[model samples]
Target: DARVTQTPRHKVTEMGQEVTMRCQPILGHNTVFWYRQTMMQGLELLAYFRNRAPLDDSGMPKDRFSAEMPDATLATLKIQPSEPRDSAVYFCASGLAPRGSGEQYFGPGTRLTVT
Candidate 1:
Protein backbone atom coordinates (compact mmCIF):
# COMPACT_ATOMS: atom_id res chain seq x y z
CA ASP A 1 0.00 0.00 0.00
CA ALA A 2 3.03 2.29 -0.20
CA ARG A 3 3.37 4.54 -3.24
CA VAL A 4 5.38 7.50 -4.50
CA THR A 5 3.43 10.57 -5.57
CA GLN A 6 4.28 13.40 -7.95
CA THR A 7 2.50 16.66 -8.60
CA PRO A 8 1.43 18.44 -11.78
CA ARG A 9 1.54 15.36 -13.96
CA HIS A 10 1.89 17.52 -17.07
CA LYS A 11 3.43 20.88 -17.75
CA VAL A 12 3.78 23.12 -20.80
CA THR A 13 5.98 26.16 -20.92
CA GLU A 14 7.82 28.41 -23.32
CA MET A 15 11.56 28.25 -23.57
CA GLY A 16 13.36 30.09 -20.74
CA GLN A 17 10.64 29.38 -18.22
CA GLU A 18 11.48 27.69 -14.97
CA VAL A 19 9.98 24.33 -14.12
CA THR A 20 9.68 22.64 -10.77
CA MET A 21 8.53 19.11 -10.05
CA ARG A 22 7.81 17.62 -6.68
CA CYS A 23 7.60 14.11 -5.30
CA GLN A 24 6.64 12.46 -2.06
CA PRO A 25 8.46 9.21 -1.53
CA ILE A 26 6.97 6.36 0.42
CA LEU A 27 7.33 6.87 4.14
CA GLY A 28 10.24 5.14 5.85
CA HIS A 29 12.11 4.68 2.58
CA ASN A 30 15.63 6.04 2.83
CA THR A 31 16.54 6.24 -0.83
CA VAL A 32 15.08 8.33 -3.67
CA PHE A 33 16.04 8.80 -7.30
CA TRP A 34 15.25 11.11 -10.18
CA TYR A 35 15.40 10.03 -13.79
CA ARG A 36 14.85 11.61 -17.17
CA GLN A 37 13.78 9.70 -20.26
CA THR A 38 14.24 10.63 -23.89
CA MET A 39 14.67 8.80 -27.18
CA MET A 40 18.34 9.67 -27.40
CA GLN A 41 19.50 8.93 -23.88
CA GLY A 42 16.80 6.41 -23.05
CA LEU A 43 16.57 6.50 -19.26
CA GLU A 44 19.21 8.44 -17.39
CA LEU A 45 19.58 8.84 -13.66
CA LEU A 46 19.71 12.52 -12.95
CA ALA A 47 20.16 12.30 -9.22
CA TYR A 48 19.77 10.08 -6.20
CA PHE A 49 19.71 10.45 -2.46
CA ARG A 50 19.97 8.21 0.56
CA ASN A 51 18.72 9.09 3.99
CA ARG A 52 17.54 12.44 2.59
CA ALA A 53 21.06 13.32 1.53
CA PRO A 54 22.06 13.73 -2.09
CA LEU A 55 24.47 11.04 -3.18
CA ASP A 56 25.23 12.16 -6.73
CA ASP A 57 23.90 14.33 -9.50
CA SER A 58 26.65 14.31 -12.09
CA GLY A 59 24.30 13.08 -14.80
CA MET A 60 22.23 16.22 -14.47
CA PRO A 61 23.13 19.56 -16.01
CA LYS A 62 24.68 21.39 -13.08
CA ASP A 63 24.04 24.86 -14.37
CA ARG A 64 20.33 24.50 -14.98
CA PHE A 65 19.08 21.53 -13.06
CA SER A 66 19.04 20.65 -9.39
CA ALA A 67 17.66 17.85 -7.23
CA GLU A 68 17.15 17.84 -3.51
CA MET A 69 15.25 16.33 -0.64
CA PRO A 70 14.09 19.04 1.71
CA ASP A 71 12.72 16.55 4.22
CA ALA A 72 12.33 12.85 4.82
CA THR A 73 9.30 12.43 2.58
CA LEU A 74 9.69 15.12 -0.07
CA ALA A 75 12.01 15.31 -3.04
CA THR A 76 12.28 18.01 -5.68
CA LEU A 77 13.72 18.62 -9.13
CA LYS A 78 14.07 22.02 -10.70
CA ILE A 79 15.11 23.37 -14.08
CA GLN A 80 15.78 27.03 -14.73
CA PRO A 81 15.54 28.56 -18.18
CA SER A 82 14.03 25.42 -19.56
CA GLU A 83 14.76 24.63 -23.18
CA PRO A 84 12.98 22.63 -25.86
CA ARG A 85 15.61 19.95 -25.48
CA ASP A 86 14.59 19.55 -21.87
CA SER A 87 11.18 18.24 -22.82
CA ALA A 88 10.84 14.76 -21.46
CA VAL A 89 9.18 12.57 -18.89
CA TYR A 90 10.80 12.92 -15.48
CA PHE A 91 10.34 10.13 -12.98
CA CYS A 92 10.83 9.83 -9.24
CA ALA A 93 11.45 6.49 -7.63
CA SER A 94 12.01 5.35 -4.05
CA GLY A 95 13.54 2.22 -2.63
CA LEU A 96 15.53 0.60 0.11
CA ALA A 97 18.62 -1.41 -0.65
CA PRO A 98 20.66 -4.26 0.63
CA ARG A 99 23.46 -2.87 -1.51
CA GLY A 100 21.55 -2.82 -4.86
CA SER A 101 19.26 -5.80 -4.63
CA GLY A 102 16.02 -4.07 -3.69
CA GLU A 103 13.24 -3.02 -6.03
CA GLN A 104 12.43 0.62 -6.67
CA TYR A 105 8.84 1.83 -6.90
CA PHE A 106 8.31 4.71 -9.31
CA GLY A 107 5.84 7.53 -9.33
CA PRO A 108 3.68 8.05 -12.40
CA GLY A 109 5.97 10.86 -13.66
CA THR A 110 5.90 14.47 -14.74
CA ARG A 111 5.70 15.01 -18.47
CA LEU A 112 7.19 18.33 -19.46
CA THR A 113 6.88 20.12 -22.78
CA VAL A 114 9.14 23.06 -23.42
CA THR A 115 8.18 25.10 -26.45
Candidate 2:
Protein backbone atom coordinates (compact mmCIF):
# COMPACT_ATOMS: atom_id res chain seq x y z
CA ASP A 1 0.00 0.00 0.00
CA ALA A 2 1.09 3.56 -0.66
CA ARG A 3 1.52 6.07 2.15
CA VAL A 4 2.84 9.55 2.76
CA THR A 5 5.86 9.88 5.03
CA GLN A 6 7.49 12.69 7.04
CA THR A 7 10.79 12.96 8.82
CA PRO A 8 11.89 14.14 12.29
CA ARG A 9 8.48 13.58 13.81
CA HIS A 10 9.29 15.89 16.73
CA LYS A 11 11.61 18.83 17.12
CA VAL A 12 12.37 21.34 19.87
CA THR A 13 14.43 24.40 19.17
CA GLU A 14 15.36 27.68 20.73
CA MET A 15 13.96 30.83 19.26
CA GLY A 16 15.77 32.21 16.20
CA GLN A 17 16.78 28.77 15.01
CA GLU A 18 16.03 27.45 11.58
CA VAL A 19 13.75 24.44 11.13
CA THR A 20 13.33 22.25 8.12
CA MET A 21 10.64 19.61 7.68
CA ARG A 22 10.46 17.02 4.95
CA CYS A 23 7.77 14.95 3.36
CA GLN A 24 7.50 12.11 0.87
CA PRO A 25 4.16 11.90 -0.81
CA ILE A 26 2.52 8.72 -1.98
CA LEU A 27 3.77 7.54 -5.34
CA GLY A 28 1.78 8.53 -8.42
CA HIS A 29 -0.19 11.19 -6.56
CA ASN A 30 -0.48 14.41 -8.49
CA THR A 31 -1.30 16.85 -5.70
CA VAL A 32 0.39 17.67 -2.39
CA PHE A 33 -0.76 19.84 0.50
CA TRP A 34 0.81 21.33 3.57
CA TYR A 35 -1.14 22.21 6.68
CA ARG A 36 -0.43 23.75 10.08
CA GLN A 37 -2.40 23.15 13.24
CA THR A 38 -2.30 25.24 16.39
CA MET A 39 -4.60 25.96 19.28
CA MET A 40 -5.50 29.43 18.09
CA GLN A 41 -5.55 29.07 14.33
CA GLY A 42 -6.77 25.49 14.19
CA LEU A 43 -6.02 23.64 10.97
CA GLU A 44 -4.98 25.93 8.14
CA LEU A 45 -3.96 24.99 4.64
CA LEU A 46 -0.55 26.56 4.33
CA ALA A 47 -0.05 25.56 0.73
CA TYR A 48 -0.80 23.03 -2.00
CA PHE A 49 0.55 22.03 -5.35
CA ARG A 50 -0.59 20.30 -8.49
CA ASN A 51 1.81 18.26 -10.59
CA ARG A 52 4.66 19.52 -8.42
CA ALA A 53 3.87 23.19 -9.04
CA PRO A 54 2.68 25.35 -6.17
CA LEU A 55 -0.93 26.39 -6.47
CA ASP A 56 -1.27 28.76 -3.50
CA ASP A 57 0.65 29.68 -0.39
CA SER A 58 -1.27 32.73 0.80
CA GLY A 59 -1.84 31.23 4.22
CA MET A 60 1.88 30.92 4.95
CA PRO A 61 4.16 33.73 6.09
CA LYS A 62 6.10 34.73 3.03
CA ASP A 63 8.98 36.19 5.02
CA ARG A 64 9.72 33.30 7.34
CA PHE A 65 8.07 30.21 5.92
CA SER A 66 8.39 28.43 2.61
CA ALA A 67 6.97 25.33 0.95
CA GLU A 68 8.21 23.61 -2.13
CA MET A 69 8.18 20.47 -4.18
CA PRO A 70 11.77 19.86 -5.21
CA ASP A 71 10.84 16.81 -7.28
CA ALA A 72 8.02 14.40 -7.88
CA THR A 73 8.20 12.60 -4.53
CA LEU A 74 9.57 15.15 -2.11
CA ALA A 75 7.98 18.20 -0.50
CA THR A 76 9.59 20.46 2.04
CA LEU A 77 8.69 23.17 4.53
CA LYS A 78 11.17 25.49 6.14
CA ILE A 79 11.12 28.23 8.74
CA GLN A 80 14.00 30.61 9.17
CA PRO A 81 14.52 32.32 12.54
CA SER A 82 11.85 30.23 14.04
CA GLU A 83 9.84 31.79 16.84
CA PRO A 84 7.69 30.46 19.66
CA ARG A 85 4.62 31.52 17.76
CA ASP A 86 5.63 29.21 14.94
CA SER A 87 5.40 26.10 17.09
CA ALA A 88 2.82 23.75 15.73
CA VAL A 89 2.13 20.44 14.03
CA TYR A 90 2.78 20.50 10.32
CA PHE A 91 1.19 17.91 8.08
CA CYS A 92 1.69 16.69 4.52
CA ALA A 93 -1.09 15.17 2.49
CA SER A 94 -1.38 13.87 -1.05
CA GLY A 95 -4.21 13.03 -3.42
CA LEU A 96 -5.07 12.35 -7.00
CA ALA A 97 -7.15 14.81 -8.99
CA PRO A 98 -9.91 14.90 -11.61
CA ARG A 99 -11.95 12.34 -9.71
CA GLY A 100 -12.35 15.00 -6.95
CA SER A 101 -14.10 12.74 -4.49
CA GLY A 102 -11.52 10.68 -2.66
CA GLU A 103 -9.86 11.47 0.64
CA GLN A 104 -6.34 12.82 0.70
CA TYR A 105 -3.74 10.57 2.36
CA PHE A 106 -1.97 12.29 5.24
CA GLY A 107 1.45 11.70 6.69
CA PRO A 108 1.98 11.42 10.44
CA GLY A 109 2.84 15.10 10.94
CA THR A 110 5.99 16.72 12.24
CA ARG A 111 5.61 18.46 15.59
CA LEU A 112 7.74 21.53 16.17
CA THR A 113 8.28 23.40 19.41
CA VAL A 114 10.20 26.65 19.75
CA THR A 115 11.23 28.11 23.03
Candidate 3:
Protein backbone atom coordinates (compact mmCIF):
# COMPACT_ATOMS: atom_id res chain seq x y z
CA ASP A 1 0.00 0.00 0.00
CA ALA A 2 1.21 3.49 -0.81
CA ARG A 3 1.60 6.18 1.85
CA VAL A 4 0.45 9.77 2.09
CA THR A 5 3.05 12.46 1.57
CA GLN A 6 3.48 15.67 3.57
CA THR A 7 5.13 18.79 2.26
CA PRO A 8 8.01 20.99 3.44
CA ARG A 9 9.56 18.16 5.50
CA HIS A 10 10.35 20.84 8.10
CA LYS A 11 9.13 24.19 9.28
CA VAL A 12 10.32 26.72 11.86
CA THR A 13 8.44 29.76 13.05
CA GLU A 14 8.18 32.07 15.99
CA MET A 15 5.57 31.94 18.68
CA GLY A 16 2.10 33.29 17.88
CA GLN A 17 2.58 32.42 14.26
CA GLU A 18 0.29 30.33 12.13
CA VAL A 19 1.09 26.94 10.58
CA THR A 20 -0.70 24.99 7.97
CA MET A 21 -0.03 21.39 6.91
CA ARG A 22 -1.49 19.78 3.86
CA CYS A 23 -1.93 16.05 3.36
CA GLN A 24 -2.78 14.11 0.25
CA PRO A 25 -4.45 10.88 1.11
CA ILE A 26 -4.32 7.68 -0.85
CA LEU A 27 -6.54 7.59 -3.86
CA GLY A 28 -10.05 6.24 -3.29
CA HIS A 29 -9.77 6.56 0.45
CA ASN A 30 -12.92 8.05 1.91
CA THR A 31 -11.72 8.34 5.49
CA VAL A 32 -8.93 10.56 6.77
CA PHE A 33 -7.48 11.12 10.24
CA TRP A 34 -5.33 13.96 11.55
CA TYR A 35 -2.71 13.58 14.25
CA ARG A 36 0.17 15.27 16.06
CA GLN A 37 3.33 14.05 17.75
CA THR A 38 5.69 15.40 20.38
CA MET A 39 8.28 13.96 22.73
CA MET A 40 6.07 14.77 25.70
CA GLN A 41 2.87 13.17 24.46
CA GLY A 42 3.71 10.66 21.78
CA LEU A 43 1.06 10.59 19.04
CA GLU A 44 -2.37 12.12 19.55
CA LEU A 45 -5.48 12.22 17.50
CA LEU A 46 -6.71 15.58 16.26
CA ALA A 47 -9.90 14.89 14.36
CA TYR A 48 -11.96 12.33 12.46
CA PHE A 49 -15.51 13.12 11.42
CA ARG A 50 -16.20 10.36 8.92
CA ASN A 51 -14.09 7.84 10.80
CA ARG A 52 -15.45 4.85 12.59
CA ALA A 53 -14.35 5.80 16.12
CA PRO A 54 -16.48 8.93 15.84
CA LEU A 55 -13.66 10.89 17.35
CA ASP A 56 -14.12 14.68 17.28
CA ASP A 57 -11.40 17.02 18.40
CA SER A 58 -9.99 14.32 20.63
CA GLY A 59 -7.09 16.35 22.02
CA MET A 60 -6.41 19.21 19.64
CA PRO A 61 -6.98 22.76 20.83
CA LYS A 62 -10.16 23.63 19.06
CA ASP A 63 -9.58 27.37 19.13
CA ARG A 64 -6.14 27.15 17.57
CA PHE A 65 -6.08 24.11 15.33
CA SER A 66 -8.38 22.84 12.64
CA ALA A 67 -8.56 19.56 10.68
CA GLU A 68 -10.75 19.19 7.70
CA MET A 69 -11.14 17.07 4.57
CA PRO A 70 -12.34 19.74 2.20
CA ASP A 71 -12.36 17.29 -0.68
CA ALA A 72 -11.96 13.60 -1.36
CA THR A 73 -8.19 13.61 -1.91
CA LEU A 74 -7.13 16.50 0.24
CA ALA A 75 -7.04 17.13 3.97
CA THR A 76 -5.69 20.09 5.85
CA LEU A 77 -4.62 21.14 9.33
CA LYS A 78 -4.14 24.71 10.35
CA ILE A 79 -2.84 26.11 13.63
CA GLN A 80 -3.18 29.79 14.38
CA PRO A 81 -1.22 31.61 17.03
CA SER A 82 1.07 28.63 17.11
CA GLU A 83 3.11 28.55 20.26
CA PRO A 84 6.42 26.99 21.14
CA ARG A 85 4.49 24.22 22.77
CA ASP A 86 2.78 23.58 19.47
CA SER A 87 6.04 22.58 17.88
CA ALA A 88 5.80 19.02 16.74
CA VAL A 89 5.51 16.68 13.77
CA TYR A 90 2.07 16.67 12.25
CA PHE A 91 0.82 13.92 9.98
CA CYS A 92 -2.30 12.25 8.67
CA ALA A 93 -3.55 8.72 8.04
CA SER A 94 -5.95 7.78 5.32
CA GLY A 95 -7.96 4.66 4.62
CA LEU A 96 -11.24 3.45 3.26
CA ALA A 97 -12.50 2.94 6.80
CA PRO A 98 -12.35 5.04 9.94
CA ARG A 99 -9.95 5.04 12.87
CA GLY A 100 -8.86 1.60 14.06
CA SER A 101 -10.69 0.04 11.20
CA GLY A 102 -7.63 -1.57 9.69
CA GLU A 103 -5.00 -0.66 7.10
CA GLN A 104 -4.35 3.06 6.86
CA TYR A 105 -1.66 4.89 4.93
CA PHE A 106 0.53 7.14 7.05
CA GLY A 107 2.20 10.32 5.90
CA PRO A 108 5.89 11.10 6.12
CA GLY A 109 4.93 14.00 8.43
CA THR A 110 5.38 17.73 8.32
CA ARG A 111 7.78 18.98 10.95
CA LEU A 112 6.77 22.29 12.54
CA THR A 113 8.78 24.41 14.90
CA VAL A 114 7.45 27.62 16.45
CA THR A 115 10.32 29.59 17.85
Best candidate according to lDDT:
2
- How many collisions per candidate? 0, 0, 1
Off-target runs (Cα >4 Å) in candidate 3 are 51-55, 98-101
Each prediction's Cα lDDT score? 0.93, 0.94, 0.80
| Winning candidate number (TM-score) | 2
Residues 1-115, model 1: lDDT tens digits: 8899998799999999999999999988889999999989899999999998889988999999988899998999999989999999999999986575588999999999999
Candidate 3 C-alpha lDDT tens digits along 1-115: 6778787689999898878888888877777788889999999988864532335776778889877777777778888989999989987888785344687778999999998
lDDT of 2 by residue, 44-106 (tens): 999999999999999999999988899999999999989999999999999998675668999
Question: In candidate 3, which residue pairs clash?
Answer: 13-115
Candidates 1 and 3, the one with greater lDDT:
1
Clashing pairs in 1: none
At residue 44, candidate 1 shows an lDDT of 95
Clashing pairs in 2: none
